[model samples]
Target: MRPKQLNFPLNPDYGTGATIRRVSLRAQSHRVDAHLLDNFHEMRCSIVHDCSIVTAITGESVRIPTTACPAAVHQLQSLVGLPISTPIRDFYAGGIARHHCTHLLDLAVMAIGHAPRPSTEILYEAEVPDELELPVPMTIWRNGRLVCRWLVRQGAILEPLELRGRPLGTGFAAWASLVFEQDQLEAATILARTWLIAIGRRYRPSQAAGRPARDNPEMLGRCYAYSTGPVETAVMTGEKEAHLHRLQREA
Candidate 1:
């Protein structure tokens, strides 16, 4: 049997009448599992009011106002937690809503360096699963070197990173907020390194042991640079860009 469809309000001000019907038209067409449809329907209902109705000629169409959508509100809330200066809040919000994950990371990097030209040099190697991985699991790399790694998993015993500093747990949330809110690569890199150092001091990992040589700050800036220095340089020098452009032309 086909599962019942759901609907949600377009504008909350319409009381109960402003909802738009959202049928499981796509799921029905695909023959997806009934349980999945039901779960989806339930989730939609919880997020907003559903209003599905039947019409004689058209059958059914969900009526929603299009003004009071949850998407805008959700996006607004996400931006609220960021530490952007008031003047650029809207700009950052729009960027976040429209950007892909990689682009967002790029923005963070640029923000850190206060670079005027947007940079897309940093590439994300993989998506690290937050819950399954270690609290302080490595999540980001620039070039071939590690830029940031997880240092503390939530719910784990708290460790002290510095001799007289607070527990590592105390700073995790703030650090995470700064990271996610970054609008440029340089900023993200700096934040990532800071997070790593905090983790290293707390956990005393061999990876975090030494300071970098003076000639190569990128190579030895921190543990991550040692592994990712060459990669970062290659990207910065336009070699990576040229190679990518060549591949695209060939394709």
Candidate 2:
């Protein structure tokens, strides 16, 4: 068997969540796919396509038939006028109608989340270092075109160094999660820790209320650096579970 694809989950520690999901879409296409697998529950499906559900067929544990309440999560048609990049905040503001289709909303969000990540130049520029000598950009590639890059200090405190040219996007962890269908429902236990290290905790350690990430190494070799990691990395795992459950309930 092939190695399991890496996906970051939003919550773990329960039979409800612990799933691995993947999302795929063609460029500039309306069609999208979401595939979800609950590893701990030993429930899995693949190569099953529902035009209604391009990715994984979700809510197996929830076990409500799609036909039972068609209106509950069928608001996707109203989303046509909206841009694919519509932020989740804006989507939430749209309000859920009693007949609104929650699965469609979830899948649509997953579709938009797969958006392309920004180049290293973009992330570097976003940091906007203080007056300094001309900075250089270093490029590394994987599989011929995948430039391998990461953020690290130049052996100094809070100093950001230049690295890769391609990343999924701002809040990439979230977007990548949607794109990859690795939300907390999939692979919860491992993904929780995986995200902690890969997303933020590994880079921005010891974050506290209001203190933020003041201990990370900076490009200046003196001051603390701005953190690019996701907020999920800072909070305890239980916090994420609570947050996700609230969102699910609201949906």
Candidate 3:
């Protein structure tokens, strides 16, 4: 059974480019003991105690499972170099969910299931590219005759790009307000929600009917969820008696 409640906030930008994922679960005799190896450029997968193992051939990205079907072993190594941004859920829905080496895929799913909340990563920062070119002036006409000419996006009248400095990526409302030159009590909601999705699978992982999270509110910027349950001692403490007792009680 899955945890009754999961809290995953966006991991800070530690600036570590290496893609990494980790997960651990415990309940009574139920346990998931697994490991996934992803080195941005290659992947290796293994699971112990269940008698499955995937090991990369020396000096090659190919992984051959020792106890699985040879064909399945051949496919295990194919996961190498998958984009770090690849959606593990989508990978499942795309027919990999029940592959020959299911433990490998399950490990990926478990990592994703324990991942940080998508909503918390909404804040983004952008820098002015060194190649940013000033827009050329464009002529505009009122009624029929030309009334005035102004730099593109009104660059001549607009604040200098550098003068504007780099604003914090947070405060979408403030950004919208600045762009519109007015309070954005309405557009702020739309912008923030749109941003969360543009950054997460919550939107456009597929079509409207295919998204996994259909329960999200129509207006997500203002919505939240909280759930809890009876407690149990943390596993891995070597307290086997307490572990089984609490799991039985929870069950």
> By lDDT, who's the top model here?
2
Q: List, residue by residue over 1-251, the lDDT tens digit for candidate 3.
A: 11122122232432212121111221111122324222111223332111122222112223221112223334445444443334433444544533434434544433232222221111111111111245332222212233222232211223334324312223433444445421122222222222222222111212222222213323222111110110111111111110011011110
How close is every model to the real structure, measured as TM-score? Answer: 0.24, 0.28, 0.21
Alpha-carbon lDDT, every model: 0.24, 0.27, 0.25
Q: Which has the higher lDDT value, candidate number 1 or candidate number 2?
A: 2
Q: Which pairs of residues clash in candidate 3, taking residues 3 or more apart in a chain or in different chains?
A: none
TM-score order of candidates, top first:
2, 1, 3
Clash tally, candidates in order: 30, 38, 0
lDDT of 2 at 180: 40
State model 2's lDDT: 0.27
List RMSD in Å for every model shown.
Answer: 25.0, 17.3, 22.9
Which tens-of-lDDT digit does each residue in 180-231 have in candidate 2? Answer: 4332322221222222222221111111223222222231111011122222
Give the runs in model 3 whose Cα sits over 4 Å from its true position.
1-74, 109-251
Write one digit per residue (lDDT tens) for candidate 1, span 152-214: 444232222431222223343344444345433333333333332221112111222222222
**Model 2 misses residue 225 by how many Å?**
46
Better model by lDDT: candidate 1 vs candidate 3? 3
